[model samples]
Target: MGLGLGFELLKTEGAARRGRLTTAHGAVETPAFMPVGTVGTVKGMLPGSVRETGAQILLGNTYHLMLRPTAERVAQFGGLHRFMNWNGPILTDSGGFQVMSLSDLRTLDEDGVTFKSHLDGRRHRLTPERSMRIQHLLDSNVTMCLDECTPFPATHEVAEKSMRLSMRWARRSRDAFVERPGYGLFGIVQGGVYPDLRAESVEALTGIGFDGYAVGGLAVGEGQQMMFDVLDFTTPLMPADRPRYLMGVGRPSDLIGAVRRGIDMFDCVMPTRSGRTGQAFVRRGVLNMRNARHAHDTRPLDEECRCPACRDYTRGYLHHLFRAGEMLGPMLLTWHNLTYYQDLMAELRRAIEEGCFERRAAELEAGLALGDLPAVPDPLAGPVAAPPVPEESSSVPVDL
Candidate 1:
């Protein structure tokens, strides 16, 4: 066995935990939010900007990089960090999720998966060994085991079969991963929404051993309540010393709820993806900046936000940019959304450390429940605006 990765659990309040994770690139405080940086780059922001947002790590997609530039090319360029100009820690997914979601044709068997690329019509095969190799080439600090993301609504029988296949893959992945100091592999637990299956998955992964553990196959359309119910039983069973990650999870409320349930790390595309669509995640709730109500409003997206978009510009300007199809619109919103997520994580860590996680969680839930503030009325369409003129019929006899 390799020298295991360092994970120091500092404090715990109820199920909430405050800890630190030491990686090859850097140390990440627990209850961390890893912005999705698929394809070696976080969608619209610069590396430095991402750091400024308080993000210590990013999650890269193994499926995308392996197909596009190819892992060999990324390795030639001194790995993903140098290539993407991000010097922080990176956790790479095992490509199984994307293979099932994005690919047109896919066949999964005990050996592995064979699929056609969504990017081009190219054929590709991904086994646990190949998945391990791809992440290794990318020089990822945290590598996830290749496992099927059990589809939601699957029968108990189907879920069991999928979970068993993933368990088999987990063993192969563990064996295939090359041991190196400061680098670690994570095992994924994949058991749809069934508590028994989830428990079995946890037993299997823990038996094989991993530096960290991730609860996969969630946020796949199962509502938050069900996801939390899974966590209720699942997280308690995870090894307390190792970091616990919830993959592809959720809105701000989802993050807070998961953290309250003892999840130490999370990765999601919601922030960046929503940002691109003119949505801003604020303390109160989500704001749709594309609305006409913001057309003449001069207030910032969130008065408390320190992000450049909120610090310097008005909602009016953001609305105009989106309306005008400006690229900067997405860039600014993405930066702000990422900053918001990191800030939330920081707050959670602080709460847990202070032994007031429950209070903080209640506060977060209350704030989210408030929803978006009432939109500012259009300033230009005041009562002094011009009145509508009645039009006379063209056939009317009128004197000029």
Candidate 2:
């Protein structure tokens, strides 16, 4: 009884697509970026502010919600929209990734995975049917299937074995999902970095069918070039009639590359997470607010950004807040980063519509290539300051 999730492909440029997704809650422009709102809230941000940043949808984690307040608790409060004060569309993952990555003692099998909760160590079981039911309880507008996210660097034998297991789970998830108007299920394609396995995964998901298809098992350990390589070959085979998503991806450049490769939807915690750690995503790339050089600087993070942090504050002031360990620092920066991401998406959509995606993308990327603005010369040129710590490596998993 499942139906298409009301996706309308309005335009295309090369491999890029411009479209819209209509859900029970609202409509999201394609090439859209969904900010991760794990545990029912986007950390350091209010729903009103997130909306102001131009986000039409938020991605929730089924594993986190199922553990904490629980899906039943959310349903009691009239679903995630009402519960979180976000009236827009919501997408929830199947809890498989978290079970595999976060949980301590995880056991995988055909029926599902059994593991202890990362938060409490309480035993729990997650099958395809249970995952579907949890998303239903949360009233998710877009529900992801319970697929095993295969780890990177595995042998072909290992990758194929994992992918095949996920394909079998996809069928179970498809059968278990209850079709509701304006709400739909998406199947994840998992094959590590293998092209043949990816082709097989695409075939498996499309054959069983879904409202949309998501390329998963990427951004795990594969570098950016490898990720692009996977998309280059794999995206062409995906059903264009349905929306195509790239799950758990990525930086601004990554988003740009993916959009250029024809992915319509994406979700990631990079922006918000960086915001908390004193990193600001600006037009000229990431600027560190924790640096001492900014202590006396008075310029805004990005002159082009309209976020309050930029419009109303200064780099010196932002630096002061972070140095003082004020909570407002993270909030203001999170708002700014989200606003930047939305602005990027809007520009990409506009570019695709205007048939100038290549030029626009080139310009945007070249801006980042220019790197952060040159440091202003120190007034006194006094004793040298501490060397800035390198931005944390992405390999280490951080909570969304």
Candidate 3:
């Protein structure tokens, strides 16, 4: 399936995989977490900063890029890597998920999907051929096939119908793909939460073939256990030789769990999005930086980490930035959270290579389960009449 590059499965511990994917840009370590750069840039981050966070790859959105500056315009600028100045592997979504998210504005047919841009009311058509063309124009190292993201809680009948349509599209996407040295195409398997449909989907996509196979249509409305259950039965059925990707998923815990179940690659906006919203991820779980508790706390975000935010800034300063609505708040938090995710992936890879995946995963989960460290004790008269709550906002968030 790899025309110019291949995935090397370097090690395994149970279902966990420690592998490397070679691409024109560079090699991506498996169980890799790709930061979402929806519109050609990882928001608030320089390419060097992203590299500092240990990110070997980034994810781009076809729909967003196509809408704003337009894919053709990007091609004129010498593709996404040059336009964005990111010199690593880039994977482009087929624009299918974004199109499906606009269900009210989109129409589906055997040939393709036609939808209006969320930005403007202007119309655009996305076929397997067009998606392939767009990613190619952007010089994507890895391109996803166009496929409908099946809704969760779907009846078997409905899920099967959606999956069949996607399989057809996957074939068209493969046929339309322009193979080049170091670039590869991946097919997405979609089948709601139905096991039978999932099996059928695995068979279909593998038969058609791809450089990698992705498990799509998850983390939509399905709960974590259901999502894990889907993976539990699904990954065992995919090709062992090719990389296995889990798309649009998830929290740190989800990444760990999926890697345990054999997923090699993942992309989601959770870290960056959560960062912008004042949420910071730590090994002991997420902490709300905007909470009044952090406004007085003098500790770094995480004492164990070395990211800039945690290395140079204190929690109090971060809280003040968010309170004042400063731009640097999101920037610092984004950097810290990305560093946490990448560090977790590195640990997982090491665990697999060292043959201690189960033990390491359990230890990581234990830390997260312990929750945010107990509220730092404040002495003297219940913190001296519970220091006046900052009134920078309409209502203060609960201090935890």
Candidate 4:
């Protein structure tokens, strides 16, 4: 193994953690939210703009990149960060989830998954070794092991079979990974929603060992409660000294819940995807900018947000841009939403460091539960004060 990546746990409040992850490219603060850059881009925003949103890391999709530009071609251009013009740390998924979810005529066996591309009728096979190689070619700072993402509502027998297969593949991935300083491979924990299966999977991964561990097989139609339930039992079993990432997770509330459960990292498409659809995530909840009520509203989307969209544009203007089908609408909203998520992660880290995570989490949940702000407010009013942070004695675990 080359120089191993480092993780420093600075503080913890209950299960919440404040840590730092040092990668080959740079260091990422935890709890952190990595913006998804599927196909080597973060949709409508520039790489520099993404960094301006306070994102220290970005996620690339192996399935998409391998199929389109091809990982080898990306390597010719000197890896994803340079190819995409983003200098931050990049983590690449092993393509297992997308293979199962997006491909057709899929077949899973001991070797790996074989499927026809969703983009075309071309067929391909992805094994653990091949997935690791692809990530390496793309120069990922963090590479994920290829594992089956067990579908929701699976029977115990089915889930067990799937998880066992993933564990076997994980071992192969670990052996295949090329150890390098500041670059690490992560194993995915599968088992659907069963605690015993989850525990078994964790044990298997730990035995094989990787640089990091990811909680997979959740957020795939399983409700938030069940997801949280899984995290409750699963996270503690993971190596406490390493980073714990929850893959393809979630709404803003989901991030908070997972962080409180000891997860240090998360990546999701909700913020950017929603932004493209005229949705904005704010401290108080989601705002649909397409609503008629905003046609004449001059207020910023969220007065507290410092993103250009909020600082320089009004709700009415955003509504007009969306209605007119302007590309700038998605660009601005994506930037704003990404900023909001990063800001939330920063606040969570601060609260954990301060030993007030429980109190801070309560205030966040209460704010989100209030839903989007009312259609009208006093023009001169400031952003609403977050509900008081509960006293330590009065604080309780936030219910998702």
Candidate 5:
């Protein structure tokens, strides 16, 4: 039976851990990967398909959902879960990231941000209280506090000022989130790679008290090593019992590193976004299906996988679908990529439970280094050279 929302750390292998997050809809095993479904839908994916990929939770964006469908409309129909037909947990992000990224038509003030919509140039404002109210109306199982994503490469002084401002907003976000049983509110830690500021931010949020804590402000164009370094210093400062979420994070390598460093949850658009662009992620690496060499290949995208795309279609068919601009190509690849990510998470959880996470992590990293099957030449490129493959490329097999 699905338990109400609560996080339980089940096992640990070094700082790396595995856990169960019981939500009103279902039990999600962690460390977990939540496929980004901003605006209540993961593009090119049906909710049932997403569930079939092993995702027990999905992420919605307050900014987009509020702007388009309007939170009230979703609530009127039934909250986000019923509206989207996803019974599993739904985690909603505060509108802060979108407001910061969509900055051209926005004004920033101490209270929050005032912006013109990218959709239709309509005026709007987003403050901590407003953000909380929006998520509450959407009935998010897990809600994030509104905090600015301090831009990368910011000077120490600028970073400090932004961090402090976010801290104040965190308090407001905390005070505004409605307390209810079987729901959670998470505070985001922002310090822009500075250890001292990160510590201060974590301490401030801990003082404010939240159901969970997120390591924010990393993976915003900062390289992996730097992001990992910050996590190395910052995650330990977070309370051990609460779930540790890394927001807006990255590739397979980044997820592996974060899991090793104690992150319990992640949400990113890489896999889905990449899938739309003809990029396919497999256990071996990434492949671009638009390449011309696949025009004659009859093999599945990844022979060892069982996603619908791989189960029912050939590389030649996928290549033709993409070349012909059929929507099915993107849908198939997106499904495969999401399935791969969820499988990766489940494998990690099992590895931790079985006390072999170290070995599994090393193996995954080694496989990533081996690269993907060569992509066919892009027709637009005319006479493009073959993709480079290291001498040891053939060593890694597609296993997912």
Candidate 6:
């Protein structure tokens, strides 16, 4: 392998591809979904449970980690992997996104962005050099370069200016990165929605060189079609041998679409976030537990699913827990959602290997549109008893 982040294309069907990426922790299957562990944890799920969901890598936020445990502390404790007790690879953002998104107030310059922290209103500075330093201290397997995440709905001029500034920062980030075996620095390509600017951004970053490339700035409120259009042109311009990561994107359909456009990696908060809100993802489609229609439903979220949420609980139980604001609601749903995503990734990899990705993609899209199970019988409206739980399974509630 070239380093911690290296791509090897195994199969291809048109623009779609099947590949493997090597990292210090292990090899991650291509077109994989990396769960967002913003603060060294993937929300409600434990690190072991997260691995059970087939996640080979997890993302950590430089802004949050730096503020909370502080990079120095994390380093002292033996980096993010040992600190979090997770053996899998971890990718740390450049602290640029959080600075732009979470910083209460901020100003940008050639040096970096100066902002007030959202946590305690403490002032801080984040530049390419500082970002590299933080991720290095964390000993992140993959580190992102510090770059301005252009504001949403920007005009052509505004986007261009921001894109150019981020390009300059990319060079500085590369220069500051420590050259070590099995460590990588990724340069983000930002151009908002302009194709020309995106091309220019790519050229600049490629000239500077990086271990990998990420397509940033698309998932910031732009519609799906626009995002796809940007990926259509942008992904091809990136080095084919290196990994192409679509950062902070997206829903299940988005993953499928991006993979169809030749993307090799992805990370997002949709599955975990939706799970916390009592939403379970199934092959058929998304199911919401908040709806009154499932008050006495006996069916599982997906009859075909073999996950804990679907195996041990009925729609009624999940519905009741969600309505009661129970922690189990988030836990079970998060688990199910993650399981579903992992299964989907496995299916995609299989299809790509079988040389039938296009056909499989069509089947998946059509299946998800078929919708959910019918509403259950109401006990008040009719004499119906609650469904019995399986004998071997315990329904004990615990906080995630």
Candidate 5 lDDT (Cα, whole model)? 0.90
lDDT of 1 by residue, 1-400 (tens): 5545899999999889999999888899999999999998899998999999999999999999999899999999999999999988999999999998853589888899999988777889999999999999999999999999888889999999999999999999999999888899999998888999999999999999999999999998889999999999999999999999999988999999999899999999999999999999998988998988888889898888999999999999999999999999999999999999999999999998888989988998898789877876665664553344457634544332
Q: Candidate 4 versus the native: TM-score?
A: 0.93
Total clashes in model 1, counting residue pairs 3 or more apart in sequence or in different chains: 0
Clashing pairs in 5: 293-376
Clashes of each: 0, 0, 0, 0, 1, 0
Off by over 4 Å in 6: 1-4, 102-104, 383-400
Whole-model lDDT for model 6 versus the true structure? 0.88
List model 6 lDDT by residue over 1-400, tens digit each. Answer: 1354666888888888888877778788887888889998998898999988888989999999988989999999999999998998888988898788863488888899998888888988888999999999998989999999987799999999999999999999988998776689999999999999999999999888888899999888988999999999898899887888999988888888898998877888888999999788888789888998888788888887777899999988999999999999999999888888888888888999999999999899888888886565676775445566578878753332
lDDT of 4 by residue, 16-115 (tens): 9899999989999999999999999999998889999999999999999999999999999999989999988999999999998853468888999898
> lDDT score, residue 306, model 5?
73
Clashing pairs in model 1, backbone N/Cα/C closer than 3 A:
none
Lowest summed-lDDT stretch of 10 residues in model 1? 391-400
In candidate 4, the residue pairs with backbone N, CA or C atoms under 3 Å apart (3 or more residues apart, or in different chains) clash, namely none
Q: Which ten residues in a row have the lowest lDDT in candidate 5?
A: 376-385
Instruction: Give me the displacement of residue 35 in model 6, in angstroms.
Output: 0.5
Q: What lDDT does candidate 1 reach at residue 331?
A: 95
Residues 333-369 of candidate 2: C-alpha lDDT, one tens digit per residue? 9999999999999999999999999999999999988
- Which residues of candidate 3, in runs, are more than 4 Å off? 377-400
Error of model 6, residue 24, in angstroms: 1.4
Compare candidates 1 and 5 on lDDT and give the better one: 1
Better of 4 and 5 by TM-score: 4
